[model samples]
Target chain A: MPSDSTIQVRQVDRYRWLVPKQGPMRVDGLVFADRRLMADVRGDQALQQVVNVATLPGIVGHSIAMPDIHWGYGFPIGGVAAFDPDEGGVVSPGGVGYDINCGVRLLRSDLVVGDIRPKLRELMNQIMRDVPAGVGVGQRDLRLGPQDLLGVLEKGARWAVEHGFGVPADLDRIESGGALSGADTAAVSPRALERGRKQLGTVGSGNHFVEVGYVDEVYDEHAAHVMGLDLDTVTVFIHSGSRGLGHQVCTDFIDVMLRATAKYGIDLPDKQLACAPLDSDEGKLYLGAMNAAANFAFANRQVMMHGVREAIERVLGRSWTKLGLDLVYDVAHNNAKWEEHQVDGRRRKLCVHRKGATRAFPPGNAELPAAYAEIGQPVLIPGDMGRYSFVLAGTERASQETFASTCHGAGRQMSRTQAKKSVRRDGRDLRREFEEMGIEVRAASFATVAEEIPEAYKDVADVVDVVHQAGIGRKVVRLRPLGVLKG
Target chain B: MEDPLGPGVREVEHTADVGIVVEASDFEQLLHRAAVGVFALMYGKADADLGPTDLFNPLGTRVHLGASDDQGNQAGMPRPITVVGSDPAAILLKWLRELLFLHETEGLAYRRATFDVVDEERVSATVWMGPEPTPAACEFKGVTYHDLDVTPGVDGWRARVILDV
Candidate 1:
């Protein structure tokens, strides 16, 4: 086991590096990045985390990382790992992270940039008022009791729709129809329930936001059309997760996995990588609880989308349907799912864990909605609020080489403390900086704006270019932020 | 005035989240100061003149302060809370998590904290909490064991914690 500084990396292609199998590794590790990005990747402990992921039981192919890889709890952010159940595969709570099914949702509108420009500030103010955000801020209007909360845990987005939060059609565009099946409410702990009761539609804090942007570039006109994205059209992106409930789920299960590791006779390099065999009782319990939490997140985003639609309608003097504010796609970046894939030329059932990675199923995959059958899954990569985000379509190469996963975002280049310190040292007002770029910023506190300055993150265009050039994902459209709301 | 905890907590560099390093001459002081660090990160510093009554009384029945403090002031002290874990590391983890839970659920922010018991497994502490003056800059989701370490060297006991923000 070499340190990050001494680790050996062999560049296999223009955008991929192979960390060959060594001591105690069941398979090799693969990192997707070009030379420039790889330098930053090598400078951190993320590569070591990649190596650590390879030692897990029943790992297949390679422990893969997207270009946005960064040091995280156990598996590196933007990491993807899969295991075959028939081969003693295991499930790890740390691999899915604390915020289960933390994801992004994009909404497209018929209105163009011209229509939104004059009303951007008013719209942002309306959204900030409608959407509950910041630390421990619960939705004032949508508190749930135990029984209704149970329905949310069980039905996911369906519950929100049934409660008049969203339309039934909205679920069609969401991942897994906006709900993961097999969610057992019994698996959810009382403490998690208490934490979740008031947080259903809230955005919480740190990196989560609601951004109003415009599609500025379309690289693939056909795919862009399929996704309802046109050049200069208005769009909204919602980034959030299950909040306190999901955190409690992960905390509860990490303790279970810690005990399960010794019982299952598994060895781990990091305690955060605690796991249990997929067939074991502990694994089954975690999967049940995790699915419930993921469902909570799905419903969370669904409800937030409803609030966004209302805000737009209230500000623009039109109904959401008249505004064409339809859901483009909702995709989870942090999750574990059971899916069938071709492994060793044989169809096998495996549990795929994508920590900070998006599912980018290619065209014609069974899981995709009929509308997206010919164009592939829509992959939304939101960058810093002041810069740009991206819309990409999945490629066959992604399905074959990376377990249908791609980068989640630009990835952080600096620590929060470092970003804040640099802002103070340079005497820069981040809000003014964004304003200079014609971007409107609204946040609960000044510290958040400083810590999330564009410089704190890598250029998202560079990250998308790597995946596009590597044939994992094809560029479809690019979005530039006009108004941003931070928790 | 000199600080009792003595230069205890400092921020550590992390790419995606917040990290902190806490040091003290003894384990009990380490635990007490770590509480201070977590609260400070969550709600900033408390005013020096604010007492426990000024903090905890607002929460009413939600808070239970067990006994009087060193000054024989019942209003200025919080009830003792005890937690048991497998080891010192686990005990520290539990202690921090309990505080986070209180903050998220009850919106309580501690003005001061003290540890009465500190061994390998069991811990008892008292915290004087008040309503947060403002929202936190960011929310810490949970504490992770990623590269977590608690060690005692010649100078004092030290611990590194990575928080999921």
Candidate 2:
């Protein structure tokens, strides 16, 4: 929850609420939540953050929050907003968050639950060994030189593909083809570069993981069939980001933006909301650096995905190709991108920021792959490890109403300490608990597992229901974990 | 001089991340205490308190000593670090950033700190580095400036900062 809360909200309908424009807000705040979710939200200051975001200069529409909204640093988690650069729209690093491009990728396989049920433990162990995880762990064997690092910053997942990590075909399934243009390596600092050097293919600690699961249910058979998600088919979910590099990029730019905010005479509700006019040099430089960092994240996940395929190959004694492992979709939940969206019946180029949210571009959007053009983008929503995750599709209503975005995941409802304390109080052993459910578990720290107990987040089904019912997101499939690896 | 207000660090609650509340008699003490607390969050306090084996190190094992250095493994040389920022909060954030970088790169945890210079814009300190930490329970991505607070009170100085865990 936020440190402060004094905003008032009125219910707009069963699944939405409105925080009317007041104070310095340029627009009203719109939040999609049921009463139960709103009750949880009202306890936190997330509503105030919605208001805070609405106060930013050049905000095009109502500051928005999804049902999964939770308290976050500057803008609330699950927040989405777009700004018009022509109207003094400013870019704020805080909106993109510290882990730039922190995202998830789903890979579908031909293997069924029966094929890997017995060897799930071995498969998980192999992946854990192949992928370096935990705090302060880095890829000792894959350190990148300056030039190689530059390539990663420039080409993103393409660099990984060229370096023999994965096939070229995998790129098409990724958001922005796994690399955003306009990346300026010159804008990335030496510190940021050094931090990212050894972390290229490693998963850093904290809410990051590689989960092996299977499709337990399919809600929209056509959408699922188009995405190759069939009932009982196995899958791999990789959730990670650019590691230290992204953090340092955000850290470095927050300072730059702070000064720019003062220089541009932009008044902010909070210092952390520091920003610069989109056309300014500072803004452009940050965009370049942020894009580079984001590319690194795209490449990071790509490399890790390859490692998982190799791990599966080693465990099952079959080539990944024979196993029919294919990229399903990769979506970044934290990022800001320039896109053209219709506003008031006119196409206006806008910079949309999705923090703790996912882009759910409607069907027929040109950005989607041809195979998915008729089904819309596949929105990967990973729930808590113990429960289930949902796969949703973008909708026309989403593009028209929310600038094409939806809830990212099951947002946290408990603080780390609170979660840990509850676990201790119950004398629960998370590993054993998960094992009892027939799920194989491996982690760098049991403390992390305890902190991320299933109850730590709201039931993702509840959150997804709101978006689905609101017509912003269309449900496609649901996945249940067979084995999990936590960083 | 014995301080009237005890210097210490306490974990504070946040919905998604971790935070620390640090209290010290002065700015330099505040930074030192906060560093210890942050490391404690990642690595447990078991190492922070030197064991009897740590006191009698026949192998001359390198040890990182804290502000109260009375025990354990061979004392290592102090490393000098200088950081400049626009304000005290910025300085604290930068200091923490450097410490985190050292932890990620050199595996050095905070042991002790001696301030040679201090001000809102610049801070120079000679810090004792510890050996590689044990497997961390958690990893902090970076320190966040969200709702960051550094204030002087009648009792002493207090700072509250959040970590992107």
Candidate 3:
């Protein structure tokens, strides 16, 4: 048997590469990338993470890496793996990531590019004023009382609608209907609650954004129309998560899982992949708290969407309803959920961990909302601020091969320090560069804007093409930014 | 403000997040340097670029958490800080995480620390605090254990830690 040091990657097809299982790995590692993208994948330590994930207990099928994969703590950013509990499967906090339920929410509006171009700056400024952002910025106006906070933990997005943060119909368009079941508030710690109290609706720090854009192209007209997309139609994308609550949840549980890992004799290739049996007391407690954190995230996006609506209303002198601002869908990229999938021609219950990946349930999947049941789940992929973002649909091939998951975003190519240093050396005015492209930019700091320069990431178009060509996801529409608010 | 490259702390690059590699004369100094490195990442080391201050000062507005007096002593009242873990690496991770939490909730940026007791499994210190500045180059979500290490070498001590942003 070849040792992990000698692990070899063989090309399976134009868009697929396979790392045959060896060493302690229980399954193969499959990566979706074209030659050009594959070169970048091999440049980082992400491939090692994929191999490490395959060594986890009870992992089913292949440990997959999407085209946008990049080096991340514990697991590669675009890694997806599912574990079978009946086969001594384990649940890991690292698999879900520090930001539990970190995800994207898309909102479609009736206004077109022509309607918003005149007041784009005003709209962006209003959004910047309305939403609390940047490092350690918490909501001043929307502090949740203890009981209300508990309701949010228990009800997720429904709590926001019930509290008048949004409309009731918004729940229908969210993954897991905006709330996962079995969230126990008791499982959450006091420290986690304290950290999240004032941060419910704030867009906390790095890479989180609220972007205003217009649909520039529609590849699948039928699917586009179903999701309220049309040429030049204005849209808003909110990328955020459960904030400190989620981070603290993952932090609190990692320590528990570490101790449990020793208790259960679960050997791990990395300390960050620390885990316990799915049925263990430690595992159940973590799931309960994680679900609570996920709920906090769902409510967070809902609250922010409401803020965006109010910002638009203030700018346009029309109610959000009159502007036809509606939530298209919300998808959580960082999560672990119990799912049923066919394994070796037999249906088995599995816990799927998607870190920096999106769930791509195919057409006819019972989990999809009725509006999208015929098309497939709307997979929201947000690119960097300057470039274009894509809307993709789930495919059957993905369900069979990857536990129905797809890429999350345009992964980073340069380190944050490198991006900053390059920007300084080139003397590029990021604000002017963005404005030159006709995109209005409002940021919490110039340093953030510099670190997040467009060149810092891979062209998302290339990543999306790989997913489309590989039949894991299908292209629907492409959106180009008009304005962005970053923290 | 102390130099970001003050021989004890240096920034390490990560694809998606940020980290620091720290070295010092001993474990206590290693812990102090790590805190400085992390706070410097959140609030740039230069006094001119401390950026905008947050609205609330839950720590009651010390005015110079990241600043030092003419005599080279850090400001703010020194408070007790104690943390425990399985090993030195774990202890460091927990210490960094504790400082991160304090920075977020109470706006306490690290000033300095006087180690009372420090070992592989535990650390107790009298930590000086300060208010956190906003509009930082970035924000870190949490400290992670991935690839974390803390070790003693002939040249003193060394540690590496990655933070999730």
Candidate number achieving the greatest DockQ relative to the actual structure: 3
Best by TM-score: 3
TM-score of the A-chain for all models? 0.99, 0.99, 0.98
- Please provide, for model 2 over A1-487, each residue's C-alpha lDDT reduced to its tens digit, 9 standing for 90 to 100: 3433467788888998989898999988999999999988888778888999999999987799999998888888999999999989989998999999999999999999999999997788788878777776777568799999999999999999999999999999999999999999999999999888888888777899999999999999999998999899899999999898999999899999999999999999888788999999999999999999999999999999999999999999999999989999999999999988888788999999999999998999999999999999999999998999999999999998899999999999999888877877777656568878878867766676777788999999999999999999999999999888787
Docking class of 3: acceptable
Q: How well is each residue in A1-487 modelled by candidate 1, as lDDT tens digits?
A: 1138777889999999999987888989999999999999998899998999999998998899999999898999989999988889999998999999999999999999999999988888888878877776787777798999999999999999999998999999999999999897898999899889888888888999999999999999999988999898899999999999999999989989999999999999999999999999999999999999999999999999999999999999999999999999999999999988888888888999999999999999998999999999999999988889999999999999998889999999998877877876787655557778988877766677777889999999999999999999999999999998887
lDDT: worst 10-residue window of model 3 chain A: A1-10
In TM-score terms, candidate 1 sits at 0.94
Q: Model 2, B31-61: lDDT tens per residue?
A: 8988888887887442222222111111222
* DockQ, model 3, C-alpha based: 0.35
What are the TM values for chain B, all candidates?
Answer: 0.72, 0.76, 0.77
**What DockQ, between 0 and 1, does each candidate earn?**
0.31, 0.30, 0.35
Candidate 3: tens digits of C-alpha lDDT, residues A244-343:
9999999999999999999999888888999988889998899999999999999999999999999999999999999999999999999999999998
Q: What TM-score fits each model?
A: 0.94, 0.94, 0.95
- The number of clashing residue pairs in each candidate reads 2, 1, 0
